[model samples]
Target chain A: MTTSKQSAPISFERERPAGKSAARYILGRRLSRVWLYTLLIVTGLAFGLPFFWTISSSLKSITEIYIFPPTMWPAEIRWKNYADVFTIAPFARFIWNTVIVTLLAMLGQILSAAVVAFGFTRFRFPGRESLFVLVLSTIMLPWQVTIVPQFLLFRYLGWINTYWPLIIPSYFGGGAFYIFLLRQFFLTIPKDLDEAAKLDGASNFRIFWNIVLPLSKAALATVAIFSFIGHWNEFFAPLIYLNSTDKFTISIGLRYFVSNPFESDEPREAILMAASLITALPVLILFFVAQKYFVQGIVTTGLKG
Target chain B: MAAATGRSWWHSSAQRREALEGYLWISPWVIGFLLFALGPMIASLYLSFTEYKIGGSPVWLGLENYIRAFSQDKLFWPSLNRTAYFAIATVGLGTVGSLLAAILLNQNARGRNFFRALYYLPSLTPVVALAILWQWLLQPQVGFVNYALYQMGIDGPGWLTSRQWAVPSLILISLWAGIGGGRMIIFLAGLQGVPQELYESAELDGASTLQRFFNITLPMISPVILFNVILGVIGSFSVFALAYVATDGGPNYATYFFVLHLYYNAFSYFQMGYASALAWVFFLIIFILSFVQIKFSDRWVYYEFS
Candidate 1:
């Protein structure tokens, strides 16, 4: 990656024509550079404008939002709209519920995925490859295939309308994708560490806990962050399992705000935008802070067969 | 071979211990797979043949649900068609758009990271927020999109409100949010893996920029392209959140996707058995599509390192 980056500018420089008049060549090159930047900046704005619109609209007054020739900046920024979001619904409770579910899910998903990945990477056991392939195959199976039966299973277990339905699955395996990711990361770790740990009288579980995990922080962080975002953004399961408004995740709560008839009459677009922003802020912030891990995870998954 | 003793490997106690430990370590996933994945799969297959409502005992229907879906269900085929349309449009547009953006970003330009981050910001936004944001942006009257169109002397059609434009509008919104996203990052990584010497040699041989890209850059990154396409297919087919929040498969069912149909049957109508049938059909479709993709990918996907 570094080699490609370094060579890129040199290649561009080398592509210059030697026979061209100096001033003309410089002028053409400058124009092309300007063109390139202009194009990039335009593309950037197209991608970035929606986020800008989201944040800008969240602070606008309802009437102002409806104004023709819509203003990019709110004429009078209403920070109180953020506060009003909570009053409009039990958004605070939704956030708390989401936080609880997300945290527990993330913990279970990372730990279970790591353990499962460890088993796959460290042991030359019977049927290991076949089991791993089975796990990978699950990634392609649409969630709908199992959703109905899973719903029934959970209902029969008396876990409907509870966070248990959302959280318990994470403790089992989290997901095949996460397990595959951690397994890839685990394979990169040298087997000598396990041997050394064994020589020190550490059990396989102890070596996995102490040696393998400690060295795989970046991969673990990737799993943790992905799990966090996934659980936080999950809608269908929470919608199906939890019937009570108080137990609603933020995603469902935001949907309720949009469709709730009592609040429909009011011009609540600004507040709705505000609520959306709040719902998305945590993941957005995490992306900025842990952008490296996010990129690494994607790259690893893409490059690996 | 050296480690293999003059005895059968199965007879070794060490190997047995390792196998036991391995199973123990992976027991969580195995248990989960049975309880969650395989168990549900088998249960759904059985349920698909019955007439199970939420609270009632399942009555054996024996292909009634499948027959109803194939012969009678009004929304089933249309929803499947709509989902296919959505998948094709998004996957097609997303792949080309992201690849182009990646190629551009791969250029040795200033403020690359800043631009990368800027473009990536939308992807990090929750789908609920993205749907809401797009809803406002695509509003026929007061929306920014129409407003901008009007500014340019073009009348924007009713987006979410119009049956004609609803699916297309959702596709456009998805492209806007996703083109600069993780897919783009994956493409960027792929772009990086293309050895610069290939380009240099091509240039030395008087290859045009276009020729070099087609001949060198694309072939080098074909494997990544294949990966993204597969993922894109799976994702677009399963798209739920945006449609659920933004349109609720509305505008005269223009956006009624396959999953939404299944969701309605399973949850709203309490036709668990029928929904299970729908799910199994969906699974088969996806499976075939994915299998076909993998089968055909060999023609285009070039794994340079492998």
Candidate 2:
């Protein structure tokens, strides 16, 4: 523990000027920053090529999708494909259902995980450490192990083909990874803050409510973003639990374009691409908004393990 | 307000009362775990010993399901072997690729943030969509992947159809999608944790980039690597959606992973008891793998903050 801190300062001094010189050397030794930028731009294009291809193809007719040499751009952006996508199945309803489930699950995950994390980090109880480890252990238990029993259990409860099976678990802390993440973050805060609250005559609940909650905004935001993205992309649970077209999440509903064994008569490729891009839009938006906190949480949580 | 001074009305409550309140606060998780997790887990163990379909009560027939899976089922051992192969390949390729990308990204290169986001984008794509995209891209005749290979004068095999190549194709696609998700993120974090002074000392000592990486960077981030490996093993074995969406575990059942087999048994074959046996076996395999990793991790994983 002491070794890392002691060595850290020494290394900082030793590396400081050498790093500056190396940076200067790389810059001065380069062909051109423009060329470096060009390489970056090309790599960026390669990385983003799929998204562009998907979008451009979504705006094209089937003939254009298979056109020889592949059209890099669409001649005419077919807006009607969007309408056709919905007509093929209840695309609108799928979108609506996906949004509903994602929001509900995200909210449930954040609230439940945070409360449990708070209990683990702030409270002194006999089984707190043991319970925390149990939570962590669940992260390793493959969902496959639980799938059969869960299926039967759901069936016995008459919960099959309903959103209840999929959405209810989040409220009960179904995913343990997020709970572990929040617990580590909560532990990082100084204990004196809690002691100060106690000195001010604050009870444990009020201290947690007023002080801990406000202090953990970043961790909370990170949890919210992760939960939203996960639930948004989830397909398997919805596939198993929702039997009706009306209850289908967007992920499952998008499968309608492909008739399982073959492509449907409609614009399957275009419509599928459209649906994929549409589903990815919310996550992309959330990523941009919470980029800093998300990255921080990932790094810190990694260290905790 | 007087609680801090040990004078509040509620503060005088007996120790038993406080303990009761603690249980009350945690009651939701306790109830939920017993109902959803503990009950199902225990019931699945029992079901594995019996024979039950989805409709009827299980009839106790100890060891039959397990024995049948081991001796009679051709698909069981093959699926397990194939899954292990795929896990090794996926984790190997995914770790190397993501580690490279993360190392490059960690350099204070301009526009790094943009590239990082771009790299992470595909990981966020729904597995179904990504599978469909890969299906199109890997189609032997119509796929862009084969098309590219064709130009190189190498005819691509039927990626999704050929039993010989189907598992590899699934592994490659999954590796590509999963690379930036956990590995890249964690590796980037590990890079940050490595003190800059170590690099400077290595450079001062005339350690080349490769030497520095092997000696310093690897040791520093071994914990993260270990963590990613554990996650990868668990994830690779439980693969469902990708194979489900991509090949439907077919072209000869070559790509049928363990979970898919379990799904087919319970849902399609209507052999709930048999599926429960398979699930327990799969869980035990994962548990053993993770336990071994944790056991070995202490030898190599460096904890900077400890």
Candidate 3:
């Protein structure tokens, strides 16, 4: 799409004679710039304010939260609400369950996705191209299409109310998008390294394990981070499979807090808000720490295709 | 080079070894496909044509579930309509909003990354949290949204409780959560891919900004736009978690999404056969929509390659 033309730079601020039209043109451009910044700031606030409100409300006293002409900042900060969240529900167990499921699922997703991606990238076997296409097409298949039968399959295996349904699927290949992403990253590595390893009597598996895995750490990190965030925030599968409150993940546990029968008349909005913030805090922290990988993963997968 | 020394394709030990290793490497995914994806797909298809509850054996009932869905089920058609409406609104407004946000973010302005991060933070929050946050934000009396409207001398409608505003409220929550997310990132990438020289050349040609955008920018980003639209359609059609947590598909079933209906049938009511039928029908609709999009994308989606 690049052009071979060489053009002189044009400036919107080029000097003009003192005339009505020129003055109007300059004023219009300046006003438009102002409008653009205004729009940006307004949009930014619209997105940012909810988060601010969420955190603020989490600290407000019960009566303060319902006062007319609601204050943006809590009148008196209730630091105990954070601790009260634990007493209100078995949040500690819920968090423990969430961490366990997330870690196992992340491990399963990264390992299986890396191995599958290596196969697609390194091997020149027959039907490889068509098989890759099959993998890509799975990205488009909605989860609802498989939910019923998969649930039945899990039920038949007597795996209900366990973490098996949530964790085991990741080992089967995590997701199509992750595999596609890793394959793209793998294709960029020089074949000379693999050839040298082979000449030194290294097997395909050894080359993959020793050389390829080390080189693709960034891509694998991206995969792991995405998998971590996904499983951490996952609500549907846990809702469907795990029946008891003892097995509830944080997502389901938060729902249980919202629907707690004892808190119906005197709903603990502050505690619920505190619990919500706690549930969402890890992902926010992860995003700030690994912002680049999140952007790279989305852009590369979405645009390169 | 290896192929040049081959005597015959079938007799080459190297090729045979490569094929075996390839299968071994991909065995996990292959096994996963059989057990998780393909197996369920076939089983679901069969289940759609039978009467199968959680504990009971399958009984053959040909076309009955499908017929009941079309002609008998009270919630089926309305739920489908609501889902379609939700999809159209979300995909339509979301694509435009994210595109605009991306273009703004792409500007050579100060604090661009800060602005982008602020916009993207909501997406990182879980849907359950978002639903809770929005439920409070949209509360008619004590909520921020209505409170602001009241200050301006215009009372805000009951967002989640009113039938007229319930779906729109859900859409608003979705937009708030998603507009600054992956779609914006994709559009930003697309925007960056457009050659800078094209704009300079257009300026020299005395092309108006509007004309330049229409002729150059739109065509360049059409493929990204198309990708986002199709994904948006699929995603909005499967709207469940927000509605489940926020509204519970209530306010007179105004936001009773397709998946929520299916979920209720399969889990709450234990009508596995009917839920499977619903799933197949939903799948067919999405499949056709996607197929048609691909067919028509040839007209608008620009590829730099041939």
lDDT (Cα atoms) of all candidates against the true structure: 0.84, 0.75, 0.86
- lDDT for A41 in candidate 2 is 71
Residues B85-200, candidate 2, lDDT per residue (tens digit)?
Answer: 98899988989878867765655466677788888877888887888777776767656677668779988899988999999899878866776665787787666667767777
lDDT of 3 by residue, A154-212 (tens): 99899999999999999997799999889888988999999999899998889999999
Query: Where is the poorest 10-residue window by lDDT in model 1 chain A?
Result: A1-10
Candidate 2, residue A230: the lDDT equals 90
Tell me chain A's TM-score in each of the predictions: 0.88, 0.84, 0.89
lDDT of 1 by residue, A1-305 (tens): 01122211111112223432221211223336677689799999898887788789999987899999899999999999999999879999999999999999999999999999988888777677778889988887888899999999899999999999999999998798899888877877889988988998998889988889999898899999999999999988898999989889999999988888653586888888899999998998998898788877877766664
Top candidate (DockQ): 1
Q: Write the per-residue lDDT of candidate 2 for residues A216-268, one digit (tens) a residue.
A: 88778878888888998898788777888778888887775564433445436
DockQ of all predictions against the true structure, Cα-based: 0.43, 0.35, 0.40
Model 3: CAPRI class: acceptable
lDDT of 1 by residue, B1-306 (tens): 124652576579998788788888899999999998999999999999999988889999999999999999999899999999999999999999998787667665678778888888888778888898899999898888898899999999999999999999999989988898889988887776666566666666977656666777778778778878988999999988899989999988889999999999999999999999999999999999999998998788776534
Report how far residue B97 has shifted in candidate 3, in Å. Answer: 0.3
* Model 3 Cα lDDT, one tens digit per residue, B1-306: 255544476368978888888888988999998888898888899999999988899999999999999999999999999999999998999999998888787665557788988988888999998898888888888988998889999989999999999999999999999899999988877776677667767767887666767788888888888889988899999999999999999988998999999999999999998899999998999999999998999898777665
Query: Each candidate's interface RMSD, rounded to one decimal?
Result: 5.8, 4.9, 5.9
How high is the DockQ of candidate 1? 0.43
lDDT of 3 at B261: 94
On TM-score, who's better, 1 or 2?
Answer: 1
Lowest lDDT block of 10, candidate 3 chain A:
A1-10
